[model samples]
Each structure stands twice: as C-alpha cells, then as structure tokens.
Target: MPESTYPRTALQRGGVPVPPLALGSWNTWDRMSKDEAVALIRRATELDAGFFDIAYYNMGPHAENSRTDILFGEALRASGVDRDGITLCGKLWLWDWPNQGFRQQLVESLGRAGLERFDTVVVGDYGKVPDMPRLVAEVNALISEGLVDSWGINNWQIAHTTQALDEAETQGVVAPVVAQLKYGIARRSMAEGEAYGALFDAGVLTLQASDVFEGGILATGRQPERKVGADVGGIREQIAAIYPEVARVAAGFGVTPAALGIAFCLSNPATANVLFGASRLAQLEQNHAALELALAHGPEVRAALAGCWVDRDVRADGVW
Candidate 1:
C-alpha cells in the first residue's frame, strides 16, 4: 500500500496530521546499538512510518549516553526525506516538570533531533499535581515562540487534564490537544472507561503507547525478566497464558501477534495515533505490517476487535 493510503489522524492542537500508527523508540532503542537503532529507524521511514517517539531520560543512570534522538536525526538525514514529511515527537522527563524546565528540555530535544521544530512534544508524567500549572505555562511559551509545533501531557488523569486545559484557556494559550497513555485490550479501563469519556467530552485527542507487548509480556509470551516482586510475576504469568489466544485470533485474521495487538488499539475511535517500540529492522517491518492491516480492516474489523477487550491491571512498575 502507498504511504498516502495509510490511515491518517489529525490532532486537536494545530490540527497537525500524523499517521494512525507511529514507530516508538523507547526500550527498543535504549537496548540496541547505535548502528542497529539507526538502521531500524531508517527502515521504518522507508516503509512509510514517518512518526517517531524518542524519550531523553530513558536509560536511567546512563541517560547521558541515551542518544536515541540523535541516532534518529542521523537516520532521517540518511533517508533523504524532507523534514516536512516526518512527524517527530519527544517528551520532557519527569525531572524536567518544574518551572521552565519543559521549555529547556524542548530546546534540547530539537537540538538532538537536528530539526528546526518538532511536530509534537509531550510533558511526561508529572509527579505532582501542582507542577501542572507550571508545565502548562512552559508548553505555552514554547508553542508561542514556535519552538514547538504542539504540546500535550502524558499519563495524566482526567481531572489533571481538565485542570491543565482550563489553566491554558485562562492564559489565552492553546489547551493540550493530545493525551498519551497506555491503552490496549487488557489495559482499556484507565483510558477507555472513565478518563477517556472525559477527554472525549473535553475534545482531547489520544496518542496510545504500549498498545501491545507491555513489559515484553506479549512479545515473549513469558513473564518479563525485568519485572520484580512476586505479585507482579504471578500476574505476568497469567497474562502470558492468554497470548496464545491472542495469537490465535490474529491467525484467524491472517496477521501476526503484534498486528493483532496494535489493531486492538486502533479500534478505539479516540486514538489519534498508535505508538509502537521496535528493537530491530525486522521488528519495524512487522509493525509496518500491522499498520497496513489496520487500514485494510476499516470500521468493521475494528469494531470486532474492540469487542474482544479483556480486563486486567497492567501497571508501569509491573502487573497490578
């Protein structure tokens, strides 16, 4: 399928357009070598997956060495695609949620990406509610200065999102147009149950990550080695047992496990874009297949997958 034929969704802020599916470089690029990471990014772009999400403080103590954004910039230059054809997205780390820190982080992200501007920059999870006001202010400053094309928050609850929007409106700044969250088959309640209704009512778009393979559970079909504690391990095993069923459903539709996993997220009407993490070129190719499959399914297939949601509590720390 042609790149233009792929499903496109527009965000509420700046009416900026992004593909329904985006290539994410969170844990994938964090663990891979620079050369491998760059090749996978270029391959994703070659396959017409133009949206890429890179986080600055992903690798914990070695955060300084976390050059995913820089590698992505190099890949983009190598791909020979015009900057306008790509949508680059990044986040402000939790540490940068303080006064004017978000703006400073935006400048750093732009410098790493080697771009004059970014399509979207999300304020990663705020550790405190009070910081929301300052973060909103910083985002507005960046947007007003043309340093950021659009701004939003990630993992914020309904009340916080509403508060931010109200604050932005009071200051005569653009309210956030997108909410980044983990929304998938087993993880629908937090996003799709109540919070999603509130966001929809308030006219906020959603950019969903971890749509599949949360904590490497779906991809490995085994308990994630990185997960700690006994309770989390038990929950991981339970979720792992259900992977075969997920794979079976995908087989019925002639798709891969990853494709079925992503399709489950694309089924949601509120989802403006689906974000996926790929560690290698092969994984990027597989995710590209999911994007095409989603486009082919259209409305009916999405409706069917939406009905197949299973309730489970999958937390960032571990399985809840």
Candidate 2:
C-alpha cells in the first residue's frame, strides 16, 4: 500500500509531507545485518511509513560513535529506494552540537546514508544549546547550504524550545519547525504538562512525537525498566495495570492496544507525526492495520480519545 493509506501526511511546519507514522531506528544498530535493515526500510516505504528517524546519540556504551546514524546510513545506502521519495530525519546529540562541524556531520551522515541531504535534522535532546547564537547560525547555514532541509529540537521541554524559537524569530533566523519528546502512555508530561503548553502557545513545532512503546513498557504490557528512574515507578505500575484495560477498550473499538495508542496520539491537533520502530516487515503491516483502524473510527472518535487522554491523563502516570 502507498503511504497515502497512512493517516495525515501534512507536517505543516516544514512543508514536509511525512506520513503520520514513521520508522524509528534508535539504538538498533549492531543488532541486525545491513541487508536486513535495508530490506526493512524498503518495505516501510511500500507501507507508507517512509519517514525514517535515527540518532547520533552517545548512549554511554550502547550507542556510542553515532551508532544509530551509522547503521541507518548503511540501511539507506542499501535500501534501493529513491532518496527523493523517502524522508530522512536524523538527530544530533549533545556530544556533537554547534561546532560539531554541521556540514561535515551532514557530509558524514550523507556518506553513511548515501544521500545528498537530509530532509530534516533534529537536536537529540534539549541539552544546553551552549552558544545559542552559534547554534542558530549553524542551523540556518545548513538550510541555506541545502545540507539539511528542516531543523528542530527533541527531548527538551518547552521552556528551552520556546526561548530558542523566540530568539531565532527575533534574530530573523530560521526557527525550528519540529519538536519531539519521549511521549507515550507511560510518559504523559510532554503532552499534558509544560512542554505541550509551551509549543502550543508558540506555534513552532509541529510534533514529531516518539516513544510510543515507552521503551518496551507499553509494548510488552509490563513494568518499565528500573533505569527509567525511581520517580516514574508509580507511573510504570499504572501502565502495567492499565495496559490490559486499554487492550479491552481497543477490543471494544475493534482495534489493538497499540492501535489505540497510535490513534490517540494522532488525534491530537498538535501532533503531526507519531514515531514508531519496527524490526520486521510484519510490524509495518501492523502499522498499516493501526492506521486503517484509526481511520475507521474516524477523526471524531480519535479526537475524543485524544481529549480524554489530555484531560484525564488517561493511562499516563503522575497526573494527580
């Protein structure tokens, strides 16, 4: 099925025509063969989940050396899909920001991915912007040079993002067009808390939401990693308890629990993209199914669900 079968493709911020659903390739390198990953990308295109995301993050040991981007580059090179057809978005982490040689990094990213330019480049997290002036200059310069098309911040709450955007606009620079966070049933703060308020008020980031599975918590229908922190334990417990309930509700709605999450996420007016990951073609089929199910329920039902989520903080922890 073409990407048209997917839900909303209007990322309004960058004029980037990205399907609401995308393939997330984070910390997945070193786990699969290059051919296997390329095949996955090629298949994702067919299903219209052509928007692909990777990160050059320094995850202590697991994702050192821009592992995600390195693997994604190989996958892109071998994907056999036309670069023009698929949207490529990558993340630049704190370890490599500002003077990280913006164009040089893009050159390396392009060489790794075998593409001339990335459709979008995002800050991996809201870590200190260091030199705000230098950051904006480098970001604008990338767009001007055509090395990167769109730029945004990820994982940073709205306060920093708001200030950055405000500064860029005041300075007549290209402000970020997208903002992302680790949002899911387990992590509601970004959606129901300050981050949402900040972006909603400013009208900058068209959401590029991530962590739908909550680092395997929602996907496995169980507890979260202890590393997710001690503070969120109660939230994790809530997710564990509510997962089956969600599954039941999804069943009543004639959809799966994951489908319910996807539908609910897309229903939000601010959400332009819901980032997801897959290890196989079968997962893309599930993505297609989720989209179809959400469509069947219609935007009204989805909107209702979305609102309930925000107002009730449904399935999210720490709402009280």
Taken over the whole model, the C-alpha lDDT of each candidate is 0.66, 0.65
* TM per prediction: 0.84, 0.82
List model 2 lDDT by residue over 1-320, tens digit each: 36477545555443857877787766554457788788888877787678888655543322445466677777777766787888888656555554465666667666665667778888664334456666778778888988887788776645566667877887898888877765654455666565464565456567776877666555557664422322333455555656665666667777666667777666556777888767766666765666766666646445434422322443222223
Regions of model 2 farther than 4 Å from truth: 1-3, 59-63, 96-101, 126-129, 192-198, 201-203, 223-234, 298-320
lDDT of 2 at 20: 76
Deviation from native of the Cα of residue 285 in model 2, angstroms: 0.8
Please report how far candidate 1 places residue 262 from its true position, in Å: 0.9
lDDT of 1 at 183: 62
The deviation in Å at residue 160 for candidate 2 is 1.2
Clashing pairs in 1: none
- Angstrom error at residue 156, model 2: 1.5
